[model samples]
Target: MSDTFDAYDDDGNRYAVPVRRSYINTSDLSGPGRIEGLPSFHLSGGGAVNRIDDQTFEIVATGKRLTVRA
Candidate 1:
């Protein structure tokens, strides 16, 4: 997956369906390289938080990873 790593669109033009991404941040309430909690809090078989900005949140899996308190 490397047509010279294509993904430019600002008058450059390049998009041939090449995809490969990754992200697994726990959430320390910060930004970038985030990893704090959620190893097993609440998530039976469906787990997905998905939010990279505005506080930050990224917890995805087959299951197990979701917590909340005060």
Candidate 2:
């Protein structure tokens, strides 16, 4: 099966997205002095999944950070 799942935005918008696992790659970055190769989900509707921590994930769409549902 694929890593696609349902995620919700801050406005309670549901989206079917695909999860991208983290690895030792140089393609993912958050900032100039930060690393962002964590496990994230790609939303088909818009934006991306930003990993806040081990047990927390957020949706970043259109420059907005949204909460995810468990």
For each candidate in turn, the TM-score is: 0.16, 0.44
| Candidate 2 accuracy as TM-score | 0.44
- Top TM-score model: 2
Q: What TM-score does structure 1 among the candidates reach? A: 0.16
- For this target, which candidate reaches the highest lDDT against the unseen true structure? 2
Compose the digit string of candidate 2's lDDT tens values, residues 1-70. 2376665666777667777765554454663343446466667655666766543456665555545466
Residue-wise C-alpha lDDT for candidate 1, range 1-70, written one tens digit per residue: 1111222233443322222233467556585574333232112223334434333233455322222211
Cα error of candidate 1 at position 37, Å: 17
lDDT agreement with native, every candidate: 0.32, 0.60
The regions of model 2 sitting more than 4 angstroms off are: 21-40, 45-47, 54-61
Give the Å shift of residue 14 in candidate 2: 0.9
What's the residue-level lDDT of 52 in candidate 1? Answer: 40
